[model samples]
Target: MTFNHIDFYDIPHVSSALETKTNSRINNCSSSVSKFILLGFSCTRDIQILLISIFSGTYISTLIGNLCIICAVRCDLRLQTPMYILLANFSFLEMCYINATVPNILANLFSEKKTISFSGCFLQFYFFFSMGTTETFFLSVMAFDRYLAICRPLHYATIMTVQRCFRMGACCWVCGFLCFLLPVYLISQLPFCCHNTIDHFLCDPGPLIKLSCSPAPTTEMICALYNSVLIFSTFLFVTSSYTLVIRAVLRVPSAEGRKKAFSTCGSHLAVVSLFYGSIMVVYVSPTAGNPAGMQKIVTLFYSVLTPLVNPLIYSLRNKEMKEVLRKLFRTVR
Candidate 1:
């Protein structure tokens, strides 16, 4: 779509230019801009090249790592339980989560314009938030799986049948995609002013809402409520599940049994902490009053870094997974 072009360098907060120039641009362009300039990282040519190289490597590694986890779970008959199935599904979701944004970010790095079409931006907005919401559901499901296996060992196998596992996984994917439809639609319908530059990397709701010519307290509240309900409800489910698991573990008389249970749960807790710790800071508040630089850093933590590290957290910490991966590598060779 055709959009009015304003040199990003002319933007007041972006550069050292005065706010008058920004006001002038906004005044001059009365119509809604159909595209937006994503001010990802303004830097020298050398630094841009360096960033491209760094993020390229990170993306490739993340894809390979998550793919390996999925493959390990699939190929190994020994790893074909409910927990492993959920783990594989989670890995696939992580791959999707990172893919929703990283490829576009990489392309923007290469292009001088760094512009994303309105449709493209909203698509990213939908998939990114959807997958993130999906992750919370998956994490909670995984925790519940652990809770059953640890706290209610007798019914674990009966309750978490293969059929039921697939059903639960399907529900997570469906619900995740559905949850954000209203909020995204509400935000998209808002009339945007002449300022078409988004301060953050991807199209986030907070920045998009900030760009609206008119105030939308209802939209803002809805977005906040969606985030709060999704994050907190799933977080509570996970924490409660783990709490019961811990109590059950403590009750075990054998030290080795308790150690084994703790070891199994440790990797999931690590992944949860990394994912939730970063996102809560950004999404919990409606305004998301954090500085642009801080927002980008925190987004990177959950979006890029968490996916990159999850494979290692799962494979390295779990003995069975490591063994299965090693054997799979040998079979490939």
Candidate 2:
């Protein structure tokens, strides 16, 4: 895949020749890029099945766990508080986020052909971005919920009413979708005259940005700026919210009150820590050599493992949820 540099601004006749040359190169490249090879988990046959089984279990468990949260929150009238509502929303978003990446991965693992079409790849990237960003927003919202519950106990109900919670959830979904539209569009517009083989398991922005044959400095800069703003702003909000929460918890006169507050927030804090920590390590660090494998492992933690754990954490730790589940089982039996 040779890229011929043509100065369209300077040479008119040469520009025509360059256009023909570029067209020829593009046609060949397009034909060759009919299917993108996904260099997934392992090259060994036995290891591939092991990877498939692991991903399948993760996918099924994630779906079931999130669905349980949603069902429990909706069915149990006693659990209809703003906090549980937000928890249900987070579970739903996590389910969508994991679904966006896991099924394709499972399919690639089992099939002999590990190729994804160009448009298919872009669509995968789009959904992954949409749901991942939504998760980030939901996390921030959850943090704010905790902040209000702890810092402003008297006003918690008024501040996080049903209407307000619904509005916040909707905004999280819409804002995340809108934020990535420009970046996805910009990446789609660039001609892939270079290698089409994406190094990672999915069509992530990092790998796609590196494969652009044209001078993509502006595109890269735009992506980096957007990612940095999203990551850093959300981190700041979460940190500040939790800091206030900690202060309020400490000021509580009773040990039981402090313990309850910490228990309510412990799971969310654990998840946020894991997610942001891995993201900073993968994206914020300088991309000198290929870190695709390492990135995939970190990506799995957030994309697969986090979703799987949300319901488990909430269910196991929450007394209200446990009672609700028990009632549901008895009713079914």
Candidate 3:
């Protein structure tokens, strides 16, 4: 069920029973596990069928909502600004984020055997986390943009030029993908013996690390360190940016100025709270301690519910976005 804490290299010569156990699971234990069983959700056939319907609808709605934001940004010339550009890309990232795991989840729910190939599991892990990392960086970047627009109004345009905005977004993507390389690689290389069943829906690092044939404190530390650095640094940057924005808004002499200032950022602030508030609970600490049900619920909150509601938050609260969507709908009709 769990690996004993031991040195990494010392794990090669495992006990005979362990070796036999590993061999029973796979023909070539030396080559590592070929597949994994994702114990996603266990329920009666009726519940699973009900879940399939619910998740399918959720997935479809999430895609459409995020896609509309992207389409609105691109089609409406008025929406072409640093903020909207970043938002459009963020929507795309959400699509990818949900896609990384939801399809497999649906598949497993429908099928009798909930098996995922080793490569498939790791790929899901990589893209899912990579998108998450990018989302953090993107959120901070969006906050910085707000800080510039609100606190340094005169310089906002000059500083966040279109070319510069693209570059910043690109940097977030590149850094996100690169940052997880070490942790994923390390976890992948560690031998997975007899137990190949992941308790959670997706191949999360916590369960993966727990499944290793030997305890890897160094790997765990590395993962924890990466999570802490990525989450805290970006979280601090977003908080700091908002702090300055709030201070600037407070200084405005007119009530209208203050109202408009808050209006510009209210949706983003809500989104930030939704994302960071839930993610911190799961990733800030080693996820080994989290109950399986809690992990699934929290992950669903951020990954599925958040994306589904984002378009509503952005479009409904902002009049311009609403108007644009109306016109686009009329044009389509």
Give all candidate RMSDs, comma-separated. 9.5, 5.3, 6.6
Question: What tens digits encode model 2's per-residue C-alpha lDDT throughout 4-85?
Answer: 9966657887878888998998777755655567777766988888888889888899898889889989999888988999
The numbered model that scores best in TM-score is 2
Better of 2 and 3 by lDDT: 3
* Per-residue accuracy of model 3 over 4-25 as CA lDDT, tens digit each: 7986546665666677886676
For candidate 3, the lDDT comes to 0.89
List TM-scores for all candidates, in order. Answer: 0.90, 0.91, 0.90
Q: Which stretches of candidate 2 lie over 4 Å from their true place?
A: 1-23, 30-32, 288-290
lDDT of candidate 2 vs native?
Answer: 0.85
Best by lDDT: 1
Q: Give the true-structure RMSD of model 3.
A: 6.6
Show model 1 residue runs off by greater than 4 Å.
Answer: 1-32
Two-way TM-score contest, 2 vs 3, winner: 2
Q: How do the candidates rank by lDDT, highest first? A: 1, 3, 2
Residue-by-residue lDDT tens digits, candidate 1, 80-186: 99999999999999999989888988988899999998888899999999999999999999999999999988998899998999999999999999999999999
